[model samples]
Every structure is written in structure tokens, then in C-alpha cells.
Target: MKAFLLVGFGGLAGSMCRYATSLLFTRAQSDFAWGTWIANVLGCLLIGLIYGLSEKFQWLTPEWRLFLTTGFCGGYTTFSAFAFENLKLLESGNYWTFSIYSVTSFAIGLLAVAAGVFLTKM
Candidate 1:
């Protein structure tokens, strides 16, 4: 029950933050789904940091790990949105944009995670 509450609260906070980020990107008036991309990449980076710190420094308890990684990061990252956006782009015949978005999101997201873990070492 305690664990559930922690994760729930973390998810609530993460969801709200994600929404705010989306709104900020919406104001940019760009066709690309910058909000979703940034959110996912950031989420990955955060999770990496959390895991790395927890492992290296033994800083986070299991409960904290659950809250931050499973709850917060899971809520913040939007794989569904990514998939839907790709579908829309494909349907609209934006192959080039779709390719670039999909490829870069994957590549950069991985790099972001690596970078986060690397930062912990420094």
C-alpha cells in the first residue's frame, strides 16, 4: 500500500510535468512532435541517472527506485504518442520526417541514457 501510494504520487507529478512540456512545445507551432520526443528522451535520461546513482552510491531505496523509474519515468515517457505520431506522419505521406523522427528519437534516446549514466561517473 505504501509503495503503491509512492508510485501513484510520482506518476501524478510526472504526468502533470509531461503535460506542461507538451503545452510549451505546442506554442512553438511546429509540425514535429517535439514535446513527445523530448519527454521520452528526458525520461530515459532520468531513469539512467536514477539507476546509476542507486547502483553506484546506494542512494535510492527500492521504494524510491520504483517511484522514480517505474512510476515517474513510465508516466512521463509516451511510446504510445510516438507510435501514433509516426502513424499520422506515414498516413500523411511525410516519409522523410517520419524516418528522421523515428530514427533520431531512438538513437538520441539511447545516447541520452548513456550520457546520464556517464554523468554519474563524473
Candidate 2:
């Protein structure tokens, strides 16, 4: 489908850009993971903008939304997805659920990555 092609192109470009940015920051000796944080924040903002625009203007093709939000933003930062899911919980007025989701996602995600790294080293 045409939308798939757009998503593919966006994914390719977004991935290459992410790789380049990661290397650029690491090479520049930037302190901390400013690169990741920056990427996440920018991705979040752009996704927000995209979502806003989507709601504001339904005239745009669905392909554009898929390319930018699903492809570019998805490739750029999964943090947007994470944040949005949490927001869904908050929106339901489930503050306790939000806290549980927050702690569990962070803790389990970190642990899982560590476990993966440790296992793959074998």
C-alpha cells in the first residue's frame, strides 16, 4: 500500500538519523546521555504536534499520519508511546494505577535489558 511505503521511507530515514545523532553526540564527548534525552524530548514534542495537527485538521491523508507519527516518531523515540499510555491511565483518574505502571515499566524495562545484555554476553 502507499501508506506502507511512506512508513517504510520514514522509518528508514528516522533510523539513520537516530544512528547519526547518537554517534555525533558520543563523538563530541557530550556529558551524560544528553543525546538520548534530547531525542526522547524532541520526539515527544513532535509526536504531540503531529497528534494535535491530526485532531485539528482531519483533511490530511492518513498516510501522512502513518509516516510521521507511526514511522518517524515511533523510530525516533518509544518514549512517546510510554508517556501516552501513562496518560491514558491518568485520564481515567487512576492515579494509583499510573504510579504502578510507572514504577513497573521503569524497573522491569531496566531489569529486562540488563538481563538481555548479561545473557547475550555468553
Candidate 3:
């Protein structure tokens, strides 16, 4: 319950940050979603930095880790979680699994979105 609360609070803040970013970086044209793209990239970078710092130093407590990584990053951009997981797989030398996971995740994720849209329309 406490962990959940921490995550929820962090998520709330992260969501607000994402919204603010979207407002600040409004795209002049619809060809690209700069706001979302920047959010994901920044989220990934932040999570990576936190992970690295935690690994190098034992400063961050479990609650802080949960709040920052799970709550904030999850809310900010789930792609960061995916990116971090992929990075871990690569670091651990699981090349084949990493390759498979990367390819299938993107390909099937796109397909899933298409399927969802089609199903919703029909």
C-alpha cells in the first residue's frame, strides 16, 4: 500500500510533466510528434541515469527507486521501461533474446495497434 502510494504520487507528477512538455513543444505540423518523442527520450535517459547511479552508489532507497523508476518513468513514458529492459538484456549478453524481443515488440506492437483500430471500427 505504501509503495503503491509512492508510485501513484510520482506518477501524478510525471504525468503533469509530460502534459507540460506537450504544451511547450507543440508541433507546428502534424508530420511529427516532437513532444511525445522528447518525453520518451528524456524519460529513457533519466531512468538510465538513475539506474546507473543506483548501481554505482547505494544512495537510492527501494521506495525512491519504485517512485522514480516505476512511477515516474512509467507515467512519463512506458517506452523508457522497454528501452531500459532492452539495455539490460544487451548488457547481460542475451543478444538473441534481445534481438527477438526488440523486433517482435515493435512489429507486433504496431500490428496490435492496427488490429485494435480495425476491431474498434468494425
Best by TM-score: 3
Candidate 1's TM-score reads: 0.61
Instruction: Give the alpha carbon lDDT tens digit for every residue of 68-117 in model 1.
Output: 87778767875634664686799899999999999999999999999999
List ranges where model 1 is wrong by over 4 Å: 78-122
Q: Rate the local accuracy (lDDT) of all candidates.
A: 0.81, 0.80, 0.94
Itemize residue pairs with steric clashes in candidate 2.
none
lDDT of 3 by residue, 1-122 (tens): 99999999989989999999888887887778989999999999999999999989988999999999999988898899999999999999999999999999999999999999999998
lDDT tens digits, residue span 51-72, model 2:
7888898755778888987788
Worst 10 residues of 2 by lDDT: 22-31
**If candidate 3 were superposed on the true structure by all CA atoms, what would the RMSD be?**
1.1
Off by over 4 Å in 2: 1-4, 27-31, 92-97
Query: How well does candidate 2 match the true structure in TM-score terms?
Result: 0.79
lDDT of 3: 0.94
Show where candidate 3 strays beyond 4 Å. Answer: none
Better of 1 and 2 by TM-score: 2
